[model samples]
Target: MTGRIHRTAAGLGPAAPVRAVHLGLGGFHRSHQAWYTAGDPEWGIAAYTFRNTELPRALTEQQGVYTLLVAGEEAEVVGSLSRAHAGADRESWLADLASPDVAVLTLTVTEAAYAVPEPGQDSAVQRVVAGLRARHRSGGAPITVVPCDNVPDNGAVLRSVLRSATRDDRRFAAWVEEQVSVVSTVVDRITPAPTDEDVAAALRATGLRDEAPVRTEPFTEWLLAGDFPAGRPAWERRGARFVPDVGVYQQRKLWFLNGAHSLLAYAGLARGHTTIREAVDDDALAGTVQQWWDTAARHIALDPAEVAEYCRRLRDRFAAPGIRHQLRQIATDGSQKIPARWLPVLRAERAAGRLPGAVVTGLAAWLLHLRGGEVRDPRAAELVESAGSVRRALLALDEEVGADDELVSAVEAELHRT
Candidate 1:
């Protein structure tokens, strides 16, 4: 390798001034928001990793520059990030939030991170409350808070949690109400955790050791709803959509894209498959995944034609040969993700007096995967302890799902068949 990548060596003169602060900086953040901001000269991100210092260290070493390796295509060097910091860098974090020039704050801290925290505990909500307090005490300016996780009504979800965090401080909460604008967003991209092989490929291609290279699929889509009071980037120029409401798009993606990925992850692992391509390529698993998609589509509010086109594109994206999306990665946090991705459709189909057979199978697979003893979840104990019984597993997922004897029986039957 020639050396570590830098703005100058990567053919980028200098990154933009820091005008945005991003939390939970990971592969998806790098591949999606950072890449989108690369097209705008006015925005630069001060990215901070949630818990891992390695990513921040690497990106900081590289001067917040990294390679975006799209599957089966040439890689691009992205430099929209001005600086990187570990989450423990609270002084800098608060300073960034306090800066009047920083108008945007984005999050990709996963669906489970939005939960209100226990007293004397640190959480995503607690962190945001701290930042807002700092900003209020300094020079309070309007800032757009964007939640790019897969939760439905993500902006509302975040705002509600923030309210809980700031319940005792009505003054701070009132200031937040007057100044903060939470934008709900639907973000899509398949950025797998970079493997050693990916790092080698990057070095071979660019003659530089890219310690933090992000390998992603070619397809990327982002839809956002709500306001940016202090202004924001022209993300539409980079194919990001500003919709009147992101609810429908979120349903379409959560049920179809994320839902199907979770299916393949759980079911595919049970069937002894590895990467996403291998899992989708299995004819038997593919059929079940398609059934899940069709069933989920029946519940989304979008036009059938639009949903179908999205599914068609998803199939191609999942079958992409160059990307190595590990099943275990998507399979993490199933206790949190399954409800968001599958519960709405499951509840709807059941209410319509339909069995939703494919969902039954998906549920069975997840239960089995839980018992396999490798899942990382806040509720792992509850899930694993209940996995032996379909009823218990269903209860662990949601009380309504478990309370329904009929639904539990269906899941039980599916588990037996598997």
Candidate 2:
């Protein structure tokens, strides 16, 4: 690799004015949204990392320009971001939110980040609400807030949270109703956290040392539904789809892609596999994934042919070589992910008087993971404490699921088999 090359707007092109502000500046954002935005040089992003100062510090030093390596294909330097800020930088964030020039705000904070706050706690939703409040106070400029997280009805969820946050201020709440648009979006991309070797390979490929390069599979998709009153990027030109309703698409991706990912994270790890590609390559795990997909297809309202094509694409993504999507990484935050990823399908299947073996097996694998030791979840302590009883643990994790004796028994039976 050649000597270190610091990426900056100066090295790429003159920085565009910030027209979009993004929350949760992570690898997925760099690989997916920022890459999409890069298609239109006129639209620049001012992004903030969720909680980490390190990434922001690194990107700020590099002037928000970073390399995006599409594994086994090519590497390109992306320079769509003009500024990087810490999420805690309320002043800067508020200024951007209140700015009439910023027509759009995007978020990639995970599902858990949308959790209703405990008093005085700062959350992603809370931060957005604060920004909106600032905007409401200073001439409300209509803006679209697109939530790109993997949650069903994400737009509705964010709107609810924002409304709740400003309920005490009747004027602000009315301003939100009049001025803000919550856009639901479904984003798909297999972006693995770059390993040391991956970073080394990027340096070798590019002949320049980059501290913040992101590695991702070639496949990517973004489907959005909602209004953008102040105008937004022509993301549709860059493989993004704008639809009247993203519900079906969202459900399809959540159940098929994310649900299967969770299954692989737990079931695959139990089978001594660490990465998605390795797990999908194994016949047994691949079959289990297919079974999960079949179960999910029953509930998701979509054309069978389309769903099949999506499934095929998902399998290809999971099996992509040189992309080490880690099970441990997917396995993190199961408590938050399970609600959207698995529970809905499981409930729907049971309500129809059929047992979902694949879903049960996935849940059983998670329970086994808890017993296996060293879980990296926020609720690890509670999960581990109840690991002895599948029913107890299920209840502790989600009361609705725990209340069902048959489901709990099924999970217990599956646990024994595992």
**Cα lDDT listed for each candidate:** 0.89, 0.87
On residues 318-402, what C-alpha lDDT tens digit does candidate 2 reach at each position? Answer: 8878899999999998988888899999889888999888888898999999999979877889889999998889998889889
Global Cα RMSD, each model:
1.1, 1.8
Each candidate structure's TM-score, on Cα atoms with residue i matched to residue i, is 0.98, 0.95
Residue 313 displacement (Å), model 2:
1.4
- On a 0 to 100 scale, what is the lDDT of residue 183 in model 1? 94
- 369: Cα error in model 1, Å: 1.0
Which residue pairs show collisions in model 2? none
Query: Quick one: how many clashes does candidate 2 have?
Result: 0
lDDT of 1 by residue, 1-418 (tens): 2789999889987878899999988999999999998889888999987778998999889999998888888999899999999889999999999999999999989888988888878777778888989999997888989999988899999999988788798888898988999999999999888898878888877888899999998889999889999989878889999889988888888889999999999999999998889999999989998899889877778888988898899999989888999999999999889999888998999899998877888898998898899779888888888888888788778999899998888878888888
